[model samples]
Target: MKDDKLFTAYIKSAEHHFSGWDFSYITDTGRMQSELLPWSYGSMAATLVQNCDAFLDMGTGGGEFLSKLRPFPEVAWATEAYPPNVPIAAKRLEPLGVKVAQVEDDTTLPFDDNQFDVIINRHESYSPKEVRRIIKDGSIFLTQQVGGTDCIQINEALGVPANDEFAHWNLHFAAEELLQNGFKITYSNESYPAQRFYDIGALIYYLKAIPWQLEDFSVEKSLEKLYEIHTQIQSNGYFDVRQDRFVIKAEAI
Candidate 1:
């Protein structure tokens, strides 16, 4: 494609509204794709939900993934820190009998002590102390986190400075933190999977959707680098990057 066409695509992607953790637009358009992890977080969460009496889902973005795991426990609750996702989560989860709470931040949990038998968190920030306080003794805490090195190649490709905010967010560190917080780590695993983007538009959309990836990212600001990547994609069919992910299952002792 020509430079003008590439510029148009980047502009369109930058202007697109990205709400609710959904990435269907890029995937459906065949612009970006990622390989699935070996293990199924959804399956594990479903099994834990089935065995627990009360459950809480942390950072349930629009309740999209949580809603898929049907037949929740008797008392089901979800917390969302993002303001726009609160109502969306409620609308989707209320019918399933799950109460969605809008939380101010990740430091405090609103629920009472021993309120839940199981807590599932996916790519959400949580306070270890709050989790320990809210969950019953011997309760389970399952979390799938995006590791610190996730998609670092995006920054490298754009010639931008790397962000070290999550530099130590790995499975080992997370497990150690849980242990220090009086939890027994039952399971832990980490993976670096490959991701591919077919077009500059998709890359722009992804960066825009996940602003933290490149906090100051903008189409105009990164035009030259984006064009370079566009040329690379045209020659190689896609631009590749590695995604960091980790899973942890801990039990309150």
Candidate 2:
């Protein structure tokens, strides 16, 4: 009966609305946590931004991360592909003089050729050709991508199929693609860090928020699996999984 009540509570908590790309609510609870990589993406972006005259932030969801790096260049722009996050990003960035544009997809950018001196993308998809067209000669492009195998254990535990669309997404492939697109790779690194879920609620919340984790994830459909995981957590105190991430820094030739 106690386990049943906990399950009910977790299911109800996971049904809340999640918007934008912010995961502060989950992270703050300390119920869901992931190990950090050795390199700091924010510091790297800040250093590059200080040297560039114009900058662009791709997939600047809710302008959460970009807004922190203040004293922006005279021209700063941001693009968000998710419809729900467009206005949220605009609201947070417009006052700071950042132009936020909504893009239907990552393949094409709505900017003119050689428009930006520095382009920063975090967990956003991009077209190599499109990036080459918008970045000025000798400009820099830095991106930290989420790898294909991130959190595969969750899918395995839930008995759901993993998304293999990005199976080839890694530091090597990304660097090669950028190099082929006329960019000289300067730095590349990849890491597999461990993530832990302290409770079933946190796991459900994460799967719900990150739909791609389990494309068709639902409490009703996965209740049996969820129950099994809940039992495991009860005995082990937490469930652990690995998270894949990679970073690349390149300069346009």
Candidate 3:
């Protein structure tokens, strides 16, 4: 007999509305726990923008993190590619003197050459040549990217193949790209930190929020595998996965 109550709970979690790159629902409640990386991307971004005249935050989803970086530069601009997030970012950032623009292509940013003194990207895709063009000479381009192997355990558990599109993206690959595109790599780090889900509901919520993890994911389709995971969690108290992350700081030549 199936556990109807638990299944209903999981369904509700999967239906939950998530916005603005915020994972606080599960994180703050301790339902999902992710270990900290060795380096802090926010702190590094703050340091890079200090006393700088102009700054740009690539893929500023809902301006959540960017808005928190107070004491902005004279010209603070942010770009959001996702349509749903564009209005959210503009609403949150514009009032704070940060102009938020909707971007369609990462390769074609709406900015003049050498416009920004500092460019920061957090888990956002970018064209190396575009970054080099937008950033001033000797300026900084800091990015913390999600590695290609991020959270493979989930895919394995769900019997889904991992997304191979960016499977080659790693610290070395990113740094070398920057080196080839008129930038000098200054700092780089990579880590596979532990991530734990205390309940099946939280896992459902996570997969729902991050659609790229399993592009074809749906609760109905993965119900059996999800139930298997739920049983594992029930017996072990949590499901563990490793999060692949890498950071790069490069200076435009």
Task: List model 3 lDDT by residue over 34-149, tens digit each.
Answer: 99899999999988776689999999998999888888977999999989999999999999899999999989999999999899999999999999988999999999999999
RMSD of 1: 1.5
Off by over 4 Å in 2: 1-3
By TM-score, the candidates rank as 3, 2, 1
Q: What shift in Å separates residue 169 of candidate 2 from its native position after superposition?
A: 1.2
Model 3's alpha-carbon lDDT is: 0.91
- Total backbone clashes of candidate 2, pairs 3 or more residues apart or in separate chains: 0
- Which is the winner by TM-score between candidate 1 and candidate 2? 2
Residues 67-185 of candidate 1: C-alpha lDDT, one tens digit per residue: 98988878999999899999999999999999999998676788998999999999999989889999999989999999999999999989986678999989998999899998998
* TM-scores of all predicted structures: 0.95, 0.97, 0.97
Q: Global lDDT of each model?
A: 0.89, 0.90, 0.91
Please list the Cα RMSD from the true structure of every candidate, rounded to 1 decimal place.
1.5, 1.3, 1.1
Task: TM-score winner between 2 and 3, please give it.
Answer: 3
Give the best candidate by TM-score: 3
Quick one: RMSD of model 2?
Answer: 1.3
lDDT at residue 122 of model 2 (Cα atoms):
95
